[model samples]
Target: MSNPKPLRKAVLPVAGLGTRFLPATKAMPKEMLPVVDRPLIQYAIDEAREAGIEEFCLITGRGKDSLIDYFDIAYELEDTLRERHKLDCLKALEPSFIEAGSLIAVRQQEPLGLGHAIWCARAFIGDDPFAILLPDDIVQAASGKGCLKQLADAYHETGGSVVAVTEVPREQTNRYGILDVGKDDGRLVEVKGLVEKPKPEDAPSNLSIIGRYVLTPEVMPYLSKLEKGAGGEVQLTDAMAKTIGEVPFHGLRYEGTRYDCGNKLGFLEAQVAFALERPDLADGVKTFLKKYIDKV
Candidate 1:
């Protein structure tokens, strides 16, 4: 309806304490943790840009100023590189650059939950449809179109809310927000309901919601209520679930490999997986992996 308002803004909720990373996250933001070479947040930002998001609001928290600084121009470093004719080095920094006024940051002020974190960006989102990309969940698209781009396209066609979903093991359904199937179309499933971290037997379906979401502004009001759900935290899933019948909501089976870099094992696996995707490092990384596996 009304042309879907043309999705342009994206919100990245990076306020988590990242207790899983502990000491490493004590000083550095977890979003700054490099997966292969680029920080995890970079991948999320790149994906948002690929989806035609022109502006971004980073839902940040205390000790997360580094996230903003990472996108700022390093004048001294750039000058030195320019003087030394290190064009390649300067070129490599392009992705980190954000045009003036294109990026903004808002403090979450509390460790409330994802819903509250997204609520903090209400002003930034205004009345426009927007996207939410979680940096901790780095999705590498198998089709070369970032996961958000895939969701964005679906949102344009359907003109409502869309979220990326993938089938997690039924036993692991408790680990994520599982979706209730309404209409099964193979590529997209109409969202009848959303259950945050449901027990295996209670889960409505194996398909679980991931980090990518294309949402209309309607969900913000639900988040504003700040009703604590599941873990006593204001869950974003709950907010989204509230809009199920009001807005056309669907779960998209996106083409991609999602890396949950929020945990230790997943983080390590992402490092190897991403490194293996790089042409410059693939051979060497493969050799090292083979040798290490042989020894193990």
Candidate 2:
């Protein structure tokens, strides 16, 4: 068997209209919404960088130019910081910098779905195995590696395709793409089948596919078919399901907390959870919570 191609590129589908966030997202891309301090897209980029991804392609839609502009250098801002001798502030901006030509932004002409959004980056993806990270789902690893980094490690070992999976309530299976398990070895579960939003009775397992995925190039042709599934949108899970028998596919039970920033409640919970994790804000946040609880 030949060696697996290294994962060097990551695709971020940031084209959603974010109807859930409404007025706040009216003028800004939902990917630009701040989780604690950093934007959701920034957190996704940071996770991808942890996995040693070299290039990034952002699949965007109308009114999402701000997502691309975030990576570009702001000369005036840098000059002001330099003049003020704010060295620490300058250092903090390092993550926002992308080497020229390494980042590409491609537009998704319509709101087809996740699969179509990813398919928009075919030219940029070329023949390499690429990772797809959805910015709406922000995952924070409990200890060592980020969610994507863990998936990347698994992909390096098993090759083909690897996706981050987390157990959800069986009743909620219809809300996500449920996985059919072949083998379970604690951390990685061999993907025997994939069901896009199956009913609770039909779900094979509670392991629901999240936003992080490390996929092989072989899956692209399946996506190109544009077969609408589940929500009448070209689902990425449907295309990925086609690759099950052909390639080595597995779902990783990553060690982390996932916050679905796509919705209001999950977004609010993420802000508090992330704030509590930071040493600088933990005590203050805790104190405020306690005081607020006493008042209530």
Candidate 3:
């Protein structure tokens, strides 16, 4: 078989209203919410860059212009920083830079579903295998390779679509897309089928897909049909299920800690966890946490 085309592009679906964030998201897009000093969307872009993604297609909605503007060169701000000789501030902005035309943002037009959001970028993806990463699912890989890179590596060997997955509690199967396991080699499992948000008793296995996906262009035709599945939204899982036998599909068990920043508690937990990982703030944060524990 011919070698699979190198994955060059990534799609990020950022059209959600972020209802869980309430007043904070009333005006600001949730993707702009900072996990520390950097916004959440920046982390996702950083991950894609690490995986060798050269082009980015962001599925945006109304009031998400800020997401597009974040990657643009800030001429006024740079001029001010240069005049003030604030080299440190200028250096911090380096990571946000994207190649002149590498970034593209497409409007989703409605609050449909993840499937529809992905479909909106079909033109941007063209005929190449592409990746999809949800900004809300922030994954920190223990190997420092990022979750997308892990799936990309597996895709190279398997020559088909690969999705990052982790074992969730049996009772929590309904919260995610559960996979029907075929062959398991500990790290990679052959995907026989997929069930979107299946009841615990009906779930095929405990392993559930996360946000990182390396999908072939073949799935686009299925998504184009706009068939609504669970929750009355066009479901990506349902579309993917139709391609099970047509192409080689597998679930990769990535080594990482995933934070669901879409929820309030999870967002707070990620903030504290990320802060503790930084050498500059680890000691101070640990001391404050101890004091709070004593007070409580």
Candidate 4:
């Protein structure tokens, strides 16, 4: 029998300085910020693992070592949990929750852009298909399939590039990399073209690329080209655009509610949504919000 293709690896770019959060991010890495109980980056890591991604490449910058340590062996913490007979909590602290050998961190060295950070992992990605997860964006779905996992499922069927996408307002198209959709299969839409922050008049469709992406190894060359675009930073959209006709690129309408945790409003919404979904806090949080809603 022919050898099966290797499972796709995931790359997460957590090297941003996160200047938006200001005082909070000054002392702690923004990706370390807790949405509820777990940190932001943890959600992304969990999502990737759930999708059967065996290896991960975290493109990190300075002041982000805490993220590495968070997933490392926390002996003292684990010991305390064990002594307290908190087996569940101790399990949460298990080292293999994020396998050490499976995860690698590479420094981006500069805040070039998303494309540059992804390129930094080229040596690690090693000419294979890979997934990119942006931790700043949190997604919640009733089903087990998170955004990245949803795309991975689609990739297996299509065997080409897949990006998680959703419809945004036509006027807001400039805020996203809008898609020029050619055909639709209800879930996966064939992408004929892509525009990065194009004016609404020029945008082909309102469908915008979300955070999750299952990309072909061919993207490495384009990302490596360091083609600077919007904000003088290397744009991933630009690279994906180059592969348009050559490779079959499709947009997946991920069935989930995506929260842009990088934004203040989105962060607040994520907190409420997560709180309401928690078995422990759901009732209390719902009661509190119902009472607070009237007063607000």
lDDT scores of the candidates, listed in order: 0.93, 0.92, 0.94, 0.88
TM-scores of the candidates are 0.98, 0.98, 0.98, 0.95
Candidate 1 lDDT, 29-99, residue by residue in tens: 99999988899999999999999999999999999999999999999999999999999999999999989
Reference-based lDDT, residue 151, model 4:
86
In model 4, where do residues sit more than 4 Å from their true spots?
1-4
For model 3 the local lDDT of residue 53 reads 96
| lDDT, model 2 | 0.92
Worst 10 residues of 4 by lDDT: 1-10
Residue lDDT tens for model 3, 214-245: 99998999999999999999999999999999
In angstroms, the error of model 2 at 87 is 1.6
Off by over 4 Å in 1: none
Per residue, candidate 4 scores C-alpha lDDT tens digits across 1-296 of 12324555999999988888988999889998888888898999888888889899899999999988887888888788889999998776653357658889999998888999999999989878899999989989757678888887888877788999999999999899899998898999999888899999998999999889999887889998998998899999999989987767899998989999998889989999999888999999999888999998
lDDT of 2 by residue, 43-106 (tens): 9999999999999999998999998889999899999999999999999899998899999999
Clashes of 1: 0
Query: Total backbone clashes of model 2?
Result: 0
Mind sharing the TM-score for model 4?
A: 0.95
Give the TM-score comparing model 2 with the true structure, all chains together. 0.98
Error of 4 at 212 (Å): 0.3
List the candidate 2 regions with Cα displacement exceeding 4 Å: none
- Sorting all predicted structures by lDDT, with the top scorer first, yields 3, 1, 2, 4
